[model samples]
Target: MKQKLIVEGHNDILVISHLLMAKNLRITGYNTKERYEKEFVSIGTGKSNNDGGKENALKAFKAALKTEELDRIGLVVDADSETANPAIDTWRSIRNILQQNGYQNLPAEPNPSGTIIAETDKALIGVWIMPNNDSEGYLEHFFEGLINPNDEFLEEARRITEGFVSDERNRFSPTHQQKAKIRTWLAWQDDPESPMGLALRDYPRLGYMSLDTPLVESFYDWLQLCFDTYVE
Candidate 1:
């Protein structure tokens, strides 16, 4: 049985692929135009460009439902919230999308683990909001959570990052605090200037924290439960 995993951007595809590789689960089919196959769960960005937000994500999902080879599907998108509060509205909107796609019985709220997985007549569907199911943020927020609190420089890093973003000349949006945090931490890495995906992939070499953090463990477990097998 084949599965499909949909995400918002290229970085997301790279991050998830690396995560799976860390667990010895090699991806069997890379998403090249004519060679794409269903032997392994297919992973791809929902939009061809950066414009593929939640709406396009849903469009991609509905489109995937039409594929005969897909027996399971998983979605990962940034919550895009303004605070660390629960993303209730975000989850509700997603549930509505599923309902429109013929799944009428999704849970009223995200499960405690921030994962939603249920069987539809055609396939198994699962959703994970980036950062966390409850958080109002993006993948950067999730990476921020992976940083070890006990690191001696954590407080100083926070202070300097907060000051940098607060500076008028930087002109950074206050909502992008997670981005600032992760970027600041990355600056301390060996490369000192890699993107989020590369930063995560090079964590071991850069002296950054590992991806095996608690939250990441839960997420990997959810991935295993959702795409690691076939139901029928």
Candidate 2:
């Protein structure tokens, strides 16, 4: 059976595809915005580069419904980058789409453990807002949380990141401070230019601990359940 997972950006497709592999979830196919398969569950970005973000995730969701052999689907978007609060606004819009499609038992709030909607006669659907469903943040914030406490350079990298501001020298949006910090940590790594995907693959060396953190565990569990990947 084939499943689909949709997210918000190019790196998400890369990061998550690799993250699943780290968890021993087999991604039979390779990367892209159309599909990534954990136990053959495909991963894709929500929108085109010109319009990527939580706001456009719905477009990807609608398209995933058209997969040739779709069985189930999972969607992950940042809560609300502008405010980083609970993703009620994001979830509300998604709920409308789900309801319109006859997917029932929609919840008013995203589950802190991640949201899964499986009913007797409808398609299985799951939704997760990053940095946990309860907080306000984007993918970078989520990546930052994946860092291991044991990593020696995390604090130093954070200190370096704090040294800069949103001035000309630092052009990243204020909401993306985590991105700079994570990337700074990555830049100091052996390869010096590892993307989010490789950062996860590098693990201990990159200060990223994939499976041990509660955040990672919960997310992995959500994927397993969403795609019907079970252990014997």
Candidate 3:
């Protein structure tokens, strides 16, 4: 009778919530941290990847297997390619659980369109490994792709952030360049220091940020397909 989505951290929560609002779509899932009384426990204590969010997600996934009243459950995780294959590792674990729960014919890998696991008398499971089904990146990469091609500010931000290596003050990992670039771009926006969630929600309202990009459209389509029947 309920639909839920489990995301990595507060950033995911903020971005997803505002993106939905910007598009005039109703909130598609419960806010586990805020709606504690509704009794939909989040996959993590708080959606903070720095605080074992990945491991917590597995616990939440395991619990959902027993919550038969749930119409659908979705997990949106970053495919952090720092050292291990976060996306594949996460999927393998969930796939194991689904197999144990009598869900048959599961794919050996995550489907590019979004992975769906379902069976009679059980809640459907939707798994989205961002930045996409194949990429080994974070949610930031997803946002980066949504930046309009004509956005000169982003190009400038990229040039500066990517060139910061010569400053001898850059300490972030190379893999996190996209994160740095996006944040820098956001900081340079008309509203300085605006967050990804706020920028995403507000920019579109102010006639910026493209909602028609293939990446944007694909993400929206994935969400719709994931919970087509569960959410109106």
Candidate 4:
């Protein structure tokens, strides 16, 4: 049987899609068909008014259930830029949407099949990958103690992100740049005591680790957990 996976994410998928392309990974309708015979579906919805973060995530999640054949889901969300802790409201909205649609009892913890990737105060998933400085190039003041301004990882990340975005200027905005940063971060957040927790507590405005890093290994772990918990 083919393995199935569902990722409820935001625009960060755009970068991930690009990263997969760089690795020669063929993503067919969200799933990396050539490698795992598995299906990867992303739900991009959220608040429609403000960049549609919430609306896009809901749309993706809803669409996945209806359009794809998946056994487990990984829901990724931001902590509202570490402003006021919007996780509860964001989660409630998501749950209401799901329950209203027909899900029975949603699990509390991030079940393997259904997980919630959240950061403290970062822009959704900015701190997870590269520091906020790399994206905004101006948030350097906020990154003190959290990350070294001249870290080598930032340069590596920049090289990897070349050609991912068309307009270089967009990489500085709180919305677009932050989203891309988070995508890169998610690709690399599994190391022991990953900076995710510390970043959150220290720099709330910069946001915490949502998934902007290249957390492929972490994602794999999450995928397996979801598969085990929900599939079989």
Candidate 5:
């Protein structure tokens, strides 16, 4: 069985792609708009926000159903809100879109493993929220979890970032604090130009953050279960 993964943006693709590589998974290549063989796992972005990206994801999911090679399809999208206490709103919005496209009986809530998956009539459909399965944040929040517990930089960055956000001159949306925090940490990297995904992949050498966390492992496992099959 060949697998397909649908993500929100380029950064999401970068993160998952690198995570797969870190686990020594031999991915053939990534395709943007074109459809490829099932032997290769192709990842496509749904744009930046939930609306457009989710729409794009539904399209990809439909396309996969038509192909005999695709046996599993996974979705990786951010919760992208201010609070996750009731992650229902965003979850419902995404769920409804998929329901229209053929996915059946998705969970009403996010899974603790950070994934909501179902064995649908079409294929195995999996949904994973960024940073965690039960969070109201984005990739930055996940990056925060991956930061080294001993890194004093994390504390210092938070301190300054909090102060900056409090300033009346600062106009970043309250929900975007995670982005501020992540960029703050990224600035200290040797190659600040490096994308967040690459920075994560090089965490060991960077010495500022460590990806050796339970959350990262959980996410890795989810990816493997969704796509790393050798079925014919």
Candidate 6:
């Protein structure tokens, strides 16, 4: 029997999926369009609200689990703005719901010594939690790692993000401050050349055309990795 693995990650999963699909990997429960739409709407409207995307993601995860012989499943969530550890709280909530529904085999935090509670025959290999913040550079670092050094997608992504941020209407539009910071930083990149050089340039406005290639490539890679590990 083939081993199974499920990764429950933040919106970055969408990016990963797009990359993987480009490689022709068979990934389940990933929606590149939805991810793009969410980002576009959030930036355009300046609202932090994810609407029903997360909920829909959860539904997709559940459906995948039911149909696949999942050998290992990892639940990934992001810690919200309030520093009270929203990610952990969300995990606990998910755990409760699973328990209520008679599903189990979840690993506790600080793994290795953590006990696994198996409520059902199917057991999850692990549950990993990663905090999603604009600062501290996880997402940016991840993107940088994925993007080719010569790729223009990075610049374009920055521009698109900047365009939204520079618009005064979006400055206070409920979007995460970190996202705003990224956009602002991208815009600053286009300023007149100076002694400061390109060391710390800001982001600029990335048009829709600029995002096509990189977005597709990144999403495909992510999907392939997930499918290889998770699909039965």
Estimate the TM-score of every prediction.
0.80, 0.82, 0.83, 0.40, 0.78, 0.41
Estimate, for each residue in 1-232, the C-alpha lDDT of model 1 and write its tens digit. Answer: 5667777766676667666655555433433423323333334434455645666776677778766457777888777565444466667777777777677678887764656556646677778888778767787777777666666565677787788766754556777666677777777767787776676667744455677677888888778676643211
lDDT score, candidate 5: 0.66
TM-score, model 6 to reference: 0.41
Q: Worst 10-residue stretch by lDDT in candidate 5?
A: 30-39
What Cα-based lDDT does every candidate model obtain? Answer: 0.67, 0.71, 0.73, 0.39, 0.66, 0.39
What C-alpha RMSD separates each model from the true structure?
4.1, 3.8, 3.5, 12.8, 4.4, 10.9
Alpha-carbon shift of residue 202 in model 2 (angstroms): 1.8
Ranking the candidates on TM-score from highest down gives 3, 2, 1, 5, 6, 4
List of clashing residue pairs for candidate 5: 46-53, 114-133
Which is the winner by TM-score between candidate 4 and candidate 6? Answer: 6
Per-residue CA lDDT of candidate 2, range 1-232, in tens? 6666777666777777677667667533423324443433333434345536665666768766644346677888887645444588778878888877777778888888899998765668888888788788777777878777657777987776666663345677666678888888888778788887887888644345645778888888888778755331
Checking candidate 3 for backbone clashes, the offending pairs are 9-47
Tens-place lDDT per residue, model 6, 1-232, is 2223333333344543443343344424433456334421121111353433344445544654566555444443333335464455556655665665467555333222122334446644233233221222223333444334454645665565556667654544534544444344444444433111121221212321122344333433333332333333
Quick one: RMSD of model 6?
10.9
Off by over 4 Å in 3: 27-43, 46-52, 82-89, 166-168, 228-232
State the TM-score for model 5: 0.78
In angstroms, give how far residue 149 of model 3 lies from its true place. Answer: 2.4
Worst 10 residues of 4 by lDDT: 122-131
Which one wins on TM-score? Answer: 3
What root-mean-square deviation over C-alphas does model 4 reach? 12.8
lDDT of 4 by residue, 63-112 (tens): 65554344444445443344343344455555665555456555432332
